[model samples]
Target chain A: MTTGNPGPTSGPVRSEFADDAEMTELVQMFVDELPERISQLNEAWNSADCQRLEHIAHQLKGASAGYGFSVVGEAAAQLEESVRQAEDNLSAATRQFDELVDLCRRATM
Target chain B: MQQQEQQPVLLLIDDSPSIHRLLGFKLKNEGLDFLAAFSGDEGLELAKSNQPSLILLDLNMPIMDGFETLHALKDDPETIEIPVIVLSGTTKPEEKVKAFELGAMDFVCKPFDIHELRVRINSAIRISRLMRMLELRAQIDGLTGLWNRAHFNERMGTELEAAQRGESEIALALCDLDKFKNLNDTFGHPAGDAVLQGFAAVLNAELRSYDIACRYGGEEFAIILPDTNLEQARSVCERVRVKISERVWPNYPKLSATASFGLTHIGADGRTDASAFVDAADTALYAAKEGGRNQVKVYSELPEAGDGPAKLALAS
Candidate 1:
């Protein structure tokens, strides 16, 4: 799959800043913090806290693009949208959350 | 009170630390004093105290959100003129309209294109700086560089209101160059202008930093001394009088000028009217001019009945 696409067999997704000399350190810091964000997402999902899930997704959607992870940002946006409209489609939100988690796992420095 | 221009301050009110970090890094070289607030409430407080030139406010904050914060900032007389730019994660048309209607100067969607954001910030700051320059020009006397009469009237009302609230003692003084017309006739108007400019310099030098000096009209000037009593005001005005009498005019080496002052104290009984207070000082000023033209006279010490000269001792 392409870098931003959610595919089970996709290779590691390199940040857009991974090649930039100036942004290397910042990009590495963002990459280092990914595990904690993933855990937070997992905790919010397992607790079935829709508000907490949407808040995290919203933050990630805004922050990921700045860190050069457009794929993660786009996934987060999709998850945020699904959760926002989850009154009748809880399954859709669940599917988006799972896709976002997979994208985060594949993200690289 | 003239303030020296400094680096423009940009306050960022956002809940996310990542946005602050990103913008802080991106805008590092933009010659801005950057301030960050994690929530809208904190941003409002900073805006009030620091008076930032521009504000970048996030619309998605919790509790006191961006809309509420913007409303509060615009509501306050102190922060109302500061320009605010709204930042949002989503570009909802209705939200954009709401933000603009609530007085936002611009709206940017996150994550920002750093270049575009920089241009927008520069343009906003430039416009604000130009506007402030224009405001200052409007209130300043063109010749003497002291505050103009209109600004003095406005400040007098404000100071009087503060005093009426029992906040502090305020003293007003009306100073006039002794025999200004004679000096103009003797050495020419240029020399008179030079003397007026020279007196303003002395006023600037003699008054405390908190004191405000204004060119009332012609060779007449007014001073507003906040948190000063009658004795304190007398000492300050005495110094101005002494300094002016001692100054030597450069081109016209033979010209020597002196000024007379009339002082009045207020807020002891919470008097609020501006004109009446001015009239009292004017009465004292008339006493100074009549009592041989080179002295400081207090309004309270003036004779109770007629327009006779005040019996207060001259400054030694």
Candidate 2:
């Protein structure tokens, strides 16, 4: 059922979406820092530094969505929201963090 | 350095009008023609069309940002080799790291430091120019500004390789000055130097425009004649030999120098090694030396040329 809905699956659908060029730039920037960000995020998550993770995730949230990686942005937003609550559900948070990493890897690689 | 005749094209991709104006003025003296693009899309388009040697990409933009622009620039085959320097306002620690990963060769922060930015651009241009110059120098002989021995070897190899694969006639000749050392021994080294320069000039003048003459070493030269057989090479070498023999040494009465040449033509089953071709010419050179020191010899029959007493002349 291809609904002809242009989205991430279509791989950068440049619409009256004046955002394509902007998204391209953001994606390029994100991919450029991806390895470093991935490493930093992994470390922060592992060390249970929720505040730092929240800060990183907050930035990623805005940036990922800007580049049309909505799912990644959404996941980053969730992770940050959970971190803000100081929730002790480490396992659940870790799962979301891992998914975020996967989303980032997919967006880039 | 004084400005060169041709100004290399430099692509400046920045959305800031002020920055553009300032840089346009700043780099006016650099002798580079600037192609400006305010947005990534525009810049990429320009890059595709112009193929600028260097790109100045701004990181922050509205619809398309610098990072995305960088990725697109790196991905495309035509623009891949073109170096990019990120000129962005994003000063975050993570941002700098990302810029490098995304194939930004260098980065400049805005409110750009004029000196730092100029230095980076200058360095990029310098390095690129140096690389091109080194490549050219590698192909040339340092002393005479002619092709070097390695170039000669490579070219000869290619010619022979082509000949071996097809029905092409390739003629190779080696010419050595006869009794050149005696000139150096009689006159000072300066006189010997004069002779070498004079010899090269005369050789350059005598050979056909298509033929290549390279100084092999002290008092020795090599000429490669394509689509020429051993007989043609022999004749060509004879003309050059006669011209050189008749040349009166400057300030030295009764002093004339001659060159002994060995010519060989490669046909079917032609050998490709530099050593083999050289050896054939060398054998002919020895024959020239033996048959009274001022003629061309072709390597037709090995046994009949007969062993003549080999007189070794030191290279001048």
Candidate 3:
């Protein structure tokens, strides 16, 4: 599924806002929202909620890099692409989805 | 003019919490109020209400996506002027085109550079503010800095409709500078223009911010006072007249000019036509002039006017 690299899943994702106090609040918000979003991501994938999966993946891909989660953005981009195209490769979709979620779980501030 | 002082508000419409967080922080230094909406529906709702200066929209949202939201915003008269910048993660050129075609002002890629985004926002806000300033200039009187006659007419229609809906009282006053022709002939056209400008300043000073003042014609003006009764409007017009009479013209120090006002209220009866309402005010103004100049009279007070000329003079 992944061509060797599964993307970063440890340590802090560096962003320009890393030094900002206001950004710390946003980091807190992201942390607070993590469990719920991760659960929804899992539920959507398991039930073949294709639209939900695509939406989550799209949001993750679009926002993760901005939040300094480059690895999560990379994985989510792959998942979003696969989900949107209705990719026949179920294993690849599963791999990318898992990787994206995994990186999100591992994300620090 | 007061609206000029507010920081331009930026609405961030993105389903992604991270995007909201990032954009909020990234653009925080730009002196803009940031409004966040997680869904396209919420975004549109906020856009319609707050009418933010600029919107940073994410292209791939749920239910109503970025394109749909952009279309909705562009379609509405209230929100149409608000500029929108699309956020796209995929770097898809076609999607970017669609966003542009649908009325997006610009785009921010997934891995956005904060400095670049700041520059884009600043540029967009600068352009928007410039455009807004031009639009407002078109509506303002060149000499007085008040709403011009055309803009006043346009605003009166809407205000009348609103007054009717709310069943609230709205007063219209038609004011004319007494013996303006004599003053002009005595002093000259430039002095006449100076008096007009000075009288406008008095009106501006005496009137509330929400009150609409306009130069209806040469040496004549109009005022629209929403949520004001006849007595209140009369007092205001009287104050303006007194202020004008008391003011010493810088160019013509000894020259003192007076203004006559015709006041009328759109009461609970719902007389909603702007033409008739204005005409009624004009008629009352004519009565003020005939009742010996420099007096404020309500249209309803005209019938009993001649009976109490002494009282009117004393009041004046």
Question: Could you say which candidate leads in TM-score?
Answer: 1
Candidate 1 lDDT, tens digit per residue, B1-316? 4678788899999998878888888899998999999998899899999999999999987788899999999899999889898998898999999999999989999877889889999988888888888998999998889999999999999988887676677899999999999999999999999999999999888999989999999999999998898899999999999999999887999999999999987645545468877887888899899999999998888875134232221110
User: Looking at candidate 2, what is the lDDT of residue B24?
Assistant: 72
lDDT for model 1 comes to: 0.87
What overall lDDT goes with each candidate model?
0.87, 0.72, 0.81
Please, what's the RMSD in Å of model 1? 3.9
Higher-ranked by lDDT: 1 or 2:
1
Q: Write the per-residue lDDT of candidate 3 for residues A1-109, one digit (tens) a residue.
A: 2358643456654443567776677766776677787999999988888888888877777766666566677778888888777654455577778877876676666
TM-score of each predicted structure versus truth: 0.88, 0.54, 0.77
lDDT tens digits by residue: candidate 3, B1-316: 6575788899998777677767777777789998989899999999999989999988777678788899999999999999998877768788888888988889888768778889999999999889989999998889877788889889888888898788888889999999999998999998999998998889879998889999988888999999887778888998998898899987788799999999877664455477767777887899899989988988767775444322322132
lDDT of 3 at B292: 94
Sort by TM-score, top down from the best: 1, 3, 2
Q: If both were scored by DockQ, which would come out higher, candidate 1 or candidate 3? A: 1
- Supply the TM-score for candidate 2: 0.54
Name the top lDDT candidate: 1
Badly placed stretches (over 4 Å) of model 2 are A1-109, B1-5, B9-26, B34-115, B131-142, B162-167, B208-210, B251-254, B268-271, B301-316
lDDT for each residue of candidate 1 in A28-96, tens digit (9 for 90 to 100): 888888889899999988877787788888888888889898888988998989998985446768779
